[model samples]
Target: MLNFKQPQLRDVIEAPADIAQVRTNLARLYQQKRQLLTDKAHWAHNDAALFEAGASYTRLFMDKMWEAFNEDKLIGDSALIEHLWLQVVQQEHGTAVNVNYADEAGENHVLFAIDQALHVQAHLTAHELPVLADITDEAPDYLINEKMFPALLQIIKLLYAADLRFRSPKETILQPVNDLHFGVKFPDAKTFTATLKVSNNVAVPVKINVEIGHYDVRSFQVVDETGNDVTTIGKPHVSASGTFSWEAQHLPELTNQTLTLTVEAVAIDTLPCLDNLFVIASGNNILMRTGEQVGSFQLELPNKQELGITVNSQDETLTLHYPDADTQIYELAKTYSFFGEWLEATLKTAIIV
Candidate 1:
């Protein structure tokens, strides 16, 4: 832990510490935010930088926290940091972060205490009130409403309904989800990027196909770091759903070249625009997000073969299952929507260097 002090708005901008220090300060601010609750002051808009500063700090903090959590640095209770945030702000769940809306009476309102923290921070930092406890910068804690709540529900319903309505007779093939899952050995691996070891016990030389299909691609280009298109078929042949396809064969025995696809979302000002992005290679499937790369899955396929898996992002937690796998319930990001500004993916064949 680093020595952290409550910062004035100027201190946050001018005397910036390393990000760890910033995180410490931000945590301290959260601990001290209870004072704001009692003051009941209206917000001031002048100290918007407070939001920006806090947002930057919180972003770094969350990243570090996630990294540590993923690496098992936190002994028993890995979710301590996340729990602490929810506890301090009195939120029931993580998604209960700062959310704003007007009440039925048409009065500006917030749905979470995190919002209250931002409100008080703005008011006190603008010098509207004497410094009340450490001014909390809750802007970073606020949840981004990438799309309206109902709109997201519709996407989920459409996908789920599509699965139910379009099931194939014998295999129960979910139209889109099954279309996303077919031909992959491990349909249940939950991850964004991974290297799958192909069993040397197999007889045939390993081969796999990678296909990404989406709607509303703002921009789509697959290339190398030097801006060269490394696709084998000249350029990836795209179909109706903005599909990009690639095939790799005889891996682990030869180090094949790599290819990448950079994608951007088409601008859609219309409300409730339903956009989609999905990638499948080997047995892995992942829903691509804006500014995210669906690449970097490096697997070695030699005499047998290796498969790299980039699993789908259905929600916060991933549950693995076969094609026949079914669950009574599932958890997914309530706010997640495929509509984003850009996406990218890279593919590499497994070969002994």
Candidate 2:
């Protein structure tokens, strides 16, 4: 394992290391990000970086979202807009409605503008405690009603009165969440008491694992609240022993608040690099002998015994192999299309060396 105390990085800008090579990986990413950001005016703002991987938005809207989240920047500016309707709506209602509303565009095509607005609002509230604060950031009465609240309420009232008055959120095509199941669930609680229920359709008992998305509750003491874990709450224990369930309880000792729970499942399901990853092990990096041009490659580790390679991990040329083998990065045709940003050149099972 690579172990070192944090060193103060001053003049040394770029360097490479083998495992956990922080500088190398970040430098490469910086280069790639710079290349993408320089040409497009869309990703001018910080928040638009999320879209560069694969997003479809004009440069103006991306800038708007970033402004809302910046610490020094408060909720102002009307330049950012994804949909024309939102621009019109804000223009009409902004001043009258106490809308200091900085707008944002999010992940959807239509009503998602509302979602983006709400998301930005939620983010703003959570970060600044805007509700309790004075009228410095937003207008006082704007909090009286939201952009969609009045409309949704009107629709609800119409539905209750048996009147087909207002359209209900534009009919949406939803994916059926039937066959796919969250086989196991972990309950976040203090004292870490009770067993959580596991849901699955399989007749035979399959080893299921528990997940609390995006929170590390390892530091929480016994019988303490798992507040930071934004997942399902205290649940009944599963019948099977060794199965885990969690709960929230008061712990007066600890200062930094978090949750802790035990999860029981087979270790086989613990393969971290399975999805979108094929291998993780040591290997002698290789080179391809293609007729057209040469590229670098690595014999990436699948495990202790086997090694396979792709372009994602390391994208340098194999200078050691030289004339003997011209390296080319290859991938599966059915799964991947290209390496890095080359749009047309699809991946193949074997490198055409």
Candidate 3:
């Protein structure tokens, strides 16, 4: 109902009444022109002052819009004005305004717009704009119940997924070297000692994690240089497959520490059957035979002399001995074969000093 239209003049003034009407219209027009001029002068002065004061005029305009919207004096759609305010913020600052939904449906568009509007509201709140902040504090009940609640829930879930995928720890602090190997005489239980070394180059103390990959571990213990049982400080986890793993609570900085693993295990008879032997033979250049094929397989010694093979069967196992050392017992189907050459080559290749 607030009108700013200029009064119009009639061309033909027929009588004295027409003259009175003309005077009234002229007075009203004059008052309207004065008001416009005053407003223009006030705007020019304020604009210059604001520029000198280094104030953001766009934010000031947004605050005024919020005021007008609250007072029911705004002439246009409130939602459109809200969208424009957010767009202005997006242009001024680099904050992301829109969330791209996979489905571009009508509801999704509404949600996107609401997201942008809320971000602008948050921006106003962050900058401590008192007018908008106080007005927004009493948000319409419909907006809270219908619009913001669902959107906030979805945003929280998205943030949690992003945090877990990108921010969680992917690997342990200490990278373990592949150095767990045990040498044992066949048909006998032997205790072997191996050292695991880790270097800590950082300034602060770090926890050390030791992982042993070998599966024959019957009993395992970790000790430090002064023969202190370091595994007592941290929990040791052993898998069903006998993989020994431990994590220590403390390791000093810029130090190279060696942790000794004392493992007791039985050998020879504990070695797995043909499937594992095939894997071992495939890498060692040793040929295998099963099911009724028996022949003398000769192997050239490291001294370049050919050693003759004598296969003796006992308890479905073939035992072949070299001059001094007994070879590893290789389990086959219904028979076990011992290869002195393979054992000699494996002892040279497998054992880590």
Name the best candidate (by TM-score): 3
lDDT leaderboard ranking:
3, 1, 2
Comparing 2 and 3 on TM-score, the stronger one = 3
For residues 1-353, could you state the per-residue lDDT of candidate 3 as single tens digits? 11223124232122232212333343344345435545776644554442322223223223333333333323233333332233222433222233222222323222231111212222211111111112232533222232322233333223222221111011110111111122322344466666756566544433343343332345667877777777666565655444555556455621577777676554332333333444555555555433222212344433443333322111223233234221112111002122323333333423222
Taking the tens digit of each residue's C-alpha lDDT, what string does model 2 give over 1-353? 01122232221222221111332333344345456775677765544353332122211222232332221111122122221132211311111011123334333223222212211121100111122112123436422223433332322222223211111111110111111111111223223232223323334222223443322223221222544542343442333322333443322333343334444222211222222122211112322221211111333222322222222112110121212121111111111221111111111121221
How does each model score on lDDT? 0.29, 0.25, 0.34
Query: Which structure is stronger by lDDT: 1 or 3?
Result: 3
Q: For model 1, what is the alpha-carbon lDDT of residue 328? A: 10
Best by lDDT: 3
Query: Over 4 Å off in model 1, which ranges?
Result: 1-10, 13-24, 28-97, 103-309, 312-353
> Lowest summed lDDT over 10 consecutive residues: which window, candidate 1?
339-348
lDDT of model 2 at residue 308?
27
TM-score of each: 0.18, 0.15, 0.20
